[model samples]
Target: MNFQHKTVIITGAANGIGEAIAYGYAKEGARVVLADIDEEKGKYLEEQLRKGSYEAYFKKTD
Candidate 1:
């Protein structure tokens, strides 16, 4: 529920379910780490989240 002061690492977070989860955690006040092979989408999502003032970052991974 409340993810305040927490950090969440979500793999495959560039799209689909993982992406949704990443947004969910960020909105719940968690620092969201988005790990995905799709660097473009991941970085885009990270930027969008940041624009909304949510703590989020993207990492390219296999």
Candidate 2:
């Protein structure tokens, strides 16, 4: 849908479903906040999203 100026928060985003959802939102032009316990994976995903020109950030939630 239209996520031009929306913000989305996704937990467990280091991999699997949460990661998928984060990318979906990012692809739809939403600012995505990814929360996960795995810092490296979370940061890697954030970097990937950024490289693809999507607004994304990683937050440690555990």
Q: Can you list the residue pairs that collide in candidate 1?
A: none
How much is the lDDT of residue 4 in candidate 2?
Answer: 95
Give the TM-score of each candidate: 0.96, 0.96
lDDT tens string, model 2, 14-47?
8999999999999999999999999999999999
- Give the Å shift of residue 9 in candidate 2: 0.3
Q: Lowest summed lDDT over 10 consecutive residues: which window, candidate 1? A: 19-28
Q: Once model 1 is optimally superposed onto the true structure by TM-score, how far is the C-alpha of residue 2 displaced, in angstroms?
A: 1.0
Angstrom error at residue 33, model 2: 0.2
